[model samples]
Target: MGPGEVAAILFGGFALLIILRVPVAFALALAVTPVFFIEPRLTPLLLMREMFKSYNAFVLLAVPFFLLAANLMNGAGITDRLIRLSQALVGHLPGGLGHVNVVVSMLFAGISGSSTADAAGIGSLLIPQMKKEGYDTSFSVAITACSSVMGVVIPPSILMVVWGGLMSVSIGGLFLAGVIPGLLIAGSQMLTVYIYAKRRNYPVSVRSNLRELISAVTGASLALVTPLIIIGGIVGGFFTPTEASVVAVLYSLVLGVLLYRTVPIRRLPSILYDSARFAAISLFCIGTASAFGWCLAYFKIPAALVSQIEMLGLGLIGTGIMVALAFLIIGMFIDAIPAIIILGTVLMPVTEHVGMNPIHFAIIGVVSLSFGLITPPYGLCLLIAASIGKIRLVDTLKDVLVLLVPMLLVLLAIILLPSVILFLPRLFMPQFVG
Candidate 1:
């Protein structure tokens, strides 16, 4: 079959399965099944081989370890400490708890690298408090869902790990490049909170005094060092990305068990089980998605796409916007990991053809995909937040869209000004950016 036919069968099948409400991982695998029979040289065994090859990477190990670290942090009461610190620092702002939700997600993002964990842990705690404080349930759920996406944009991101491993981008450079964009997203969310607070007359806490700020800082200082240790270790050449994830897991164990003593020793098993369960889900998606991606490559679909896009004569900024828009749409339908495998691969050639830096392209993809976490149909983070808030998903739509405007602007800024994403990576890791 021709590339067009293969593309049709692959994508059409996947879309049909998705519409049937099949799980994405299974749908991805199932989508490629007919292709094996139609293509003369392909077989069912190729699927297993490709899936195994995808899993047989050292860097992919980071996905589970980072997830475990996030779970452990939650189990250890570390999130509570960060919440307290956020309350002290931003609670005096208009929509005080809203600000706290954004701040804590930023801080937790540095450590957890899993937005779902941030939405679950932070949402479970703050959504109730925001409601109790007389904030609108939809607004509380929306802010929590929107801000939690920073978990994948900031350092130690699991998506970056997967992207780096699959696409051969520098994990450290991606991590460094992410810092500014992540902060920009958080700042925009805070500004949104301010506007919401003013219009709604949301409560603001008394401004924290010097001693209170210091105490809050001191209380969460150890947790705050997590990003530094993970990012520094990788960029400083002390560890590979895989090793850094292991280190994060060990550090979280230390804090939970020995340092903070918040996590009981007996609770370890359940934490391990939960982490494994979540990891299995994500890793399974990678396996099936990788197989599906292999079919795309086998059909030379990406090369065809690159040639077609080149015909348009789009420049760097134009191509960047196109890339973001594609990921944004696909991400709304699929999990980010699979979206990265499927869409990121297709677009890599397009970006490279335009001379866009890989790290810049990566940040655009990551940031854009992060939106899926909060958008409809497949907005995992929003669903989690809505579940916690006990509100209808549709109720949060207006507020979520309002919060997303600022984030979309930040994404556009990175696309228009490479410096927004490139400066930190260039300053700190010049070798990788080049």
Candidate 2:
């Protein structure tokens, strides 16, 4: 059979499984099976081999470690401390807890590297408080969902690690590339909160005294250093991103056990087990997605995509806009990890053909999909927030649409002005562009 016929069997089967509500990992594996049977030269064993190959990379090891580190920090009482610190910094701002939500997510984004973690950890902490203070549940859930996306855009991002591992790009360069856009997104969210707070007359906390602010920061100092250690270790040549994950785990452990005394030794086993369970699920999706991506490559889907794109005569800017839109749409359906594994490889050639920087394209892809974490149908962050708020998903989406306006604007800025994404990478990783 021709490759097109095979591609149809693979993707069509994948879609059928998704419609049937099979899990994504199983859906991907099941989708690729019929193609193997039909091709005669390929075997089911090849699927297993490809899945194994996907996780064989050393950098891919960072996914679980980062996840464990984030989970540990959540259990270690770091969330409340970060909340205290955020309140101290932004509590005086209009929509006190609203601003606190965005700021805490930004700070936690540095530590967690997972948006769902951000929404769950920070949202569970603040959403109730915001509601008690008269903030609407939908608005509380909306801000939590929107701001948690920074967890992926910020450095030490698991999605960026997955992207770097799959595409063989520089993880450190990707880390640097994410910093500015993450900050910009955080700033935009804060501005949105300001506008909402003023119009809604949301309550504001009394300005924190300097001494209390110092106390909050001092209490949260160890937790605050988690991101610095991860990013510093990677960027300073002290370790690879994988080793940096180790540093994050160790730092969170010591900070939790020795300093905070929140993580008792007795709880260690359960924490590790839960972390392993979540990590297994994520890695499983990644493995299957990699195999699915391999099938696409085998059928030359990327080349066909590039050729079709080239014929449109969309120059670099137009092609990038297309990349951003495509990922945004796909992200609404798929989790970012698997999406990165499957789509990053498929789209790399298309972007490169248009003279776009790989790092720029990487940021564009990450930022665009970050929104998907909140959009409906598969908005993981939104689902987490809505669940915490005990509100329906559709109601929370009302506010999500408002948040998306600012986020989309920032995304457009990154797309039109590549420098926004590249500035940090070029500044820090001179060798990347060189």
Candidate 3:
């Protein structure tokens, strides 16, 4: 077979491996093995060199530290405090319980940077209340799952960070770009919840007493600072995102261990151990994807694909539309992290050649990928919320469709108009160009 055919088979095999639930790292390495032997110019040493070189960047340093911070915040009861804070602020509106679920998801997105974490954290707190408040179990669970996508779209998103490193886009710009869209999604969800609440008459407590409101603010102020600290640390030039992750860990530790005093020092080891495991998965998949992309390049997949597309005359807008559609579809099936790793590596060159902004593309990519976390079937958040609400996936998936429409429109606007993302980054930090 030609090298391209060999590469095609390898890619097919890789997809099969993923479907079979074989780990992505194994799938990636296996996909690349053919190139190692077939192309003598690309030796086994080349693959290893690629892996080592790929991971050698200082930016990659932030990945593990950010994952660690997420783990610690989860373990230290930081997530719960933040949930309560979101609830206090938004829990009394019609469909207030649903709003609480989403608002909390967006807030937690900043801290956890993982949609799964968002689902797990906010689902545990909000789902029961939603059920008790007379929301349909399926609808409630679906809404919870849907809202968790905000984690990746909001700043400090792990997916964005990965894309930033891969595409050489501005991480800060990506963060800023996500700010308006994230709020838009949260607002959309809130609006949807309001409509649902009014239509169905879901239970809502009377707006909280002023004393409770005041008390809620007093108690939750510390937790609210988590995002502020993250944004300021990165935006103010005090640290890079990875550096900010370390700062986050230290900050969460200080608040949880010293000030709030929830995360016991003795329990730190377990937190580290848990975090290490998740981080290992992230790094391994990343290294493996790098290897797989190397293998693809060895066979000239991007160049071949780009040539074919360029011939087809699908200009930037057409390509963007098609790519956006594909991403939204795949986002429903795959988790954001590895999806970004695979697609970003392959499509980045094409995007750049078309004169697209890498930062804008990353924001679009992450947000587009986020749909997969909440959609039916393979969505990780769907399952998480289902488990919490004890709702069948089939029953909840329908309602999720209603919310998906508006979300897609918002994504389209961002894709067509690059300014939504680039504006804030330019306004605030002109110097931090990717």
Q: What tens digits encode model 1's per-residue C-alpha lDDT throughout 281-346?
A: 999999999999999999999999999998999999999999999999999999999999999998
Checking candidate 3 for backbone clashes, the offending pairs are 62-242, 331-372, 332-372
Once superposed on the true structure, which residue ranges of model 3 sit more than 4 Å away at CA?
Answer: 1-3, 432-434
RMSD of 2: 1.1
Q: By lDDT, who's the top model here? A: 1
Each candidate: how many clashes?
Answer: 0, 0, 3
TM-score attained by model 2: 0.98
Residue 8 accuracy (lDDT) in model 2: 82
lDDT of 2 at 62: 91
Runs of candidate 1 exceeding 4 Å displacement: none
C-alpha lDDT score of every prediction, in listed order = 0.95, 0.89, 0.78
Each prediction's RMSD to truth: 0.8, 1.1, 2.0
Please tell me which model should have the higher TM-score, number 1 or number 3.
Answer: 1
Off by over 4 Å in 2: none
lDDT for 37 in candidate 3 is 80
lDDT of 3: 0.78
